[model samples]
Structures are given as C-alpha cells and as structure tokens.
Target: MKVRVGFGYDVHALVPERDLWLGGVKIEHTMGLQGHSDADVLIHAICDALLGAANMRDIGYHFPDTAGEYKDIDSKILLFDTMELLRDAGYTLGNIDATVAAERPKLNPHIPEMKRVMADVLQVDVEDISIKATTTEKLGFTGRQEGIAAYATVLIQK
Candidate 1:
C-alpha cells in the first residue's frame, strides 16, 4: 500500500454576530471567525490536509470564495466532499491529528464533541481523528482573541 501524509493550516479573523464553529460543533462564543463560508477553520484545515494528501490541491481550489454557492455554506459539506474526492482517487484515510488555536471560550472542554461530530461527518471511527486545542500564550492573533487558527495533519493510503 502506498501511504502519504499531508498538512494543512487555516486562520480567520474574529467578528461579531457570527457563530463559532469548530470541528463541526457549534460553540458558544462572543466572537466568531469571519469568512465567506461558515468560517469553520478546523474543518477547512482538515479539508485542505485531505486534499493535499491526495495531491488534489487545496480547498480554495475546489471551493472558491468567489463562488456564490459556497457563500455562507456549511464547512462540513466541504469536508465530506473532500473525503469523497479522495475515495474516488483510490485513497483511504489512515488517521488525522488536528489542533485549533484560540484564546477564549476554552476549547479543551469541547474536544470530545468536536471529535464525535467530525468523525460522523467523515464517516470514520472517532479513534482515527484526534482533535486538540491550545492557546498561543497571548503571543499571536489567536491569543489576543483577534482570530482563530487551526492546523491539521493527515495520513492516507491507497
């Protein structure tokens, strides 16, 4: 079997009136990430990682913000579509390790739900996907609560 790995990262600014979504789970927060879609940075990172692993390009290539169909669209759909593209290309998911960076609302407590939701969306065992969250120690935009960022690494095999 041929095995490959891919890494992805995404970030978005925080803005008022937007809902916070990470790993497919909506969390209570005073500010939400701003983007053309639902602004789920974690999900976007995962999508990019999966696409990169398969050499299929990134999420923006497949789903451009300029397209009206993707405006305010749910990011989970993008993730699901990305997985389908990989499957069609004869690749199967091996595992994924992902981390989200944010300063407020404390993410560790929501990791479980995030894993469950993402696993369901990816149709993979929850064990195959590991989600973690951290603070930047007030060193970056994330720590300052100006924005949120996420990183994802994935292993895939054919």
Candidate 2:
C-alpha cells in the first residue's frame, strides 16, 4: 500500500452576532468565526489535510470563496465533497489528528461530538479521527479570544 501524509492549518476572526461552528458542531461563545462559509476552522483544516495527502490541491482550490455558492455554506457539505475528491483520486483515509486553539467556550467538552460528526461525514470509523483542543495559554489571537485556529494532520493510503 502507498501511504502519504499531509498537514493543514486555518484561522478565522471572531466577531459578534454569528454562531461559532468548529469541527462540524456549534459551540456557545460570545463571538463566532467570520468567513464566507460557516467558518468551521477544524473542518476546513481537515479538508485541506486530506486533499493534500491525495495531492489533489486544497479546499479553497476546489471551493472558491469568491463564488457565491460558498457564502454562508455549511462546512459539512464541503467536507463531504472533499472526501469524494480524495476517493476519486484512489486515496483512502488512514487517520487524522487535529487540534483547535481557542481561549474560550471550552473546546474539550465538545470534542467527542466533533469527532463523531467528522467520522460520519468522512464515512470512516470514529477511531480514525482524533480531535484535540488547547487554549494557547492566552498568548495569540486565539488566546486573546479574537479568533479560532485549527491544525490538522492526516495519513492516507492507496
């Protein structure tokens, strides 16, 4: 079997009056991530990781932010579409490990749901996906509560 690895990172500004969507689930927060899509930073990172592993380009390359079709679009749809692209490229998911950095709303409590939702969307075992959270100890934009950021690493095989 041929195995490959890829990494992805994403960040979004936080603002009032929008829901905070991360890792495919909404979390209660004073500020939500701002972007053309739902701004699920974790999902976007994972999509990029998978696409990279398959050498199929990144998420924005497949789904352009300039296109109106992605405006306020549910990120889960993009995740599903990304998986299809990988499958078409003859790549199968091996595993994923991801981390979300946020200073508030307590991402740890929501990690289980995030893993479940992503596993379902990718049609993979939940055990194959790992989600982790950190606070950055109040250091950067995420630590200062100005935004949320996520990083993902994935392994794929053919």
Candidate 3:
C-alpha cells in the first residue's frame, strides 16, 4: 500500500448575519464566518488536506471562489466532491485529525455532531475522523474573536 500525508489550514473572518458552519454542521453563534461558500472552515481544511494527499492541487483549484456557482454553496457538497476526487485518484482515506481554533461559542459541545456530519459526507467511519477544538489564549484573530481558523492532517492510501 502506498500512503501519503497532507496538511491544510484555513481561516475566515467572523461577521454578523451569517451562519457559523464547521465540519458541515452549523453552530449557533453571534457571528459567522465570511466566505464565498458556507464558510465551514473545518470542511474546507479537510478538503485541502485530501487534495494535497492526492497531489491533485487544493480546493481553490477544484472549486474557485471566483465562480458564482460556489457563492453561498453548502460546504458539505464541497466535501463530497473532494472525496470523489480522491477516490478518482485511487486514494482512500486512512484517517483525519483536525483542530479548530476559536475563542467563543464553545466548540467542544458541538464536536460530536461535527464528526458525524463529516463522516456521513465523506462516507467514512466516524472513528476515522477526529475533530478537536482549542482556544488561542486570547491572542491573534481567533483569540480575539475576529475570525475562526482550522487545521487538518490526513492520511491516504492506495
């Protein structure tokens, strides 16, 4: 078996009047992430990791923000498409570990749902995907509640 590893990171500014989405699940919060899509930072990071593992480029390459079709699109669709792209490249997921950084709204309570949602979207065992949350200790954009950021690492094999 051939195994490959990839890493991804993403950030989005928080703004009013938008729904906060992470790992394909929406969380109730005073502010939401701003982006062309639903701005699920976790899912976007995972997609980039998968694409990088397959050496097929990144999510922006496959789904450009400049395209009107992606405007306000659901990120779960993007995750599904990313999985298809990996499968087409003859790569299957081994595992994924992802972390989200935020200062408010308490992410820990929502992690389980996020894992379930992402697993369903990727058609993978929930055990294969691990989602974690953390605070930046009142530093940087995430710490200051200006934005949310996520990092993901993935293992893929053929």
Q: Tell me the lDDT of candidate 3.
A: 0.94
The TM-score of predicted model 3 comes to: 0.99
In the range 10-71, model 1's lDDT, one tens digit per residue, is 99999999999988889999888899999999999999999999999999999999999999
Per-model TM-score versus the true fold: 0.99, 0.98, 0.99
Which lDDT value does model 1 have at 123? 90
User: Scored by CA lDDT, what does every candidate get?
Assistant: 0.94, 0.93, 0.94
Worst 10 residues of 3 by lDDT: 22-31
How well does candidate 1 score on lDDT at residue 115? 91
Candidate 2 global CA lDDT score = 0.93
Q: For model 3, how does the per-residue alpha-carbon lDDT over 24-110 read when each residue is reduced to its tens digit? A: 888999999999999999999999999999898999999999999999999999999999998988999999999999999799989
Give, for candidate 1, the lowest lDDT window spanning 10 residues: 135-144
Clashing pairs in 2: none
Question: In candidate 1, how many Å is residue 63 off?
Answer: 0.4
How do the residues 1-158 of candidate 2 rate in per-residue lDDT, one tens digit apiece? 99999999999999999999998998888889999999999999999999888888899999999999999999999999999988988899999999998889888889999999989999999999999998899998888899989999999999
Cα-based lDDT at residue 59, candidate 2: 91
Clash numbers, per candidate: 0, 0, 0
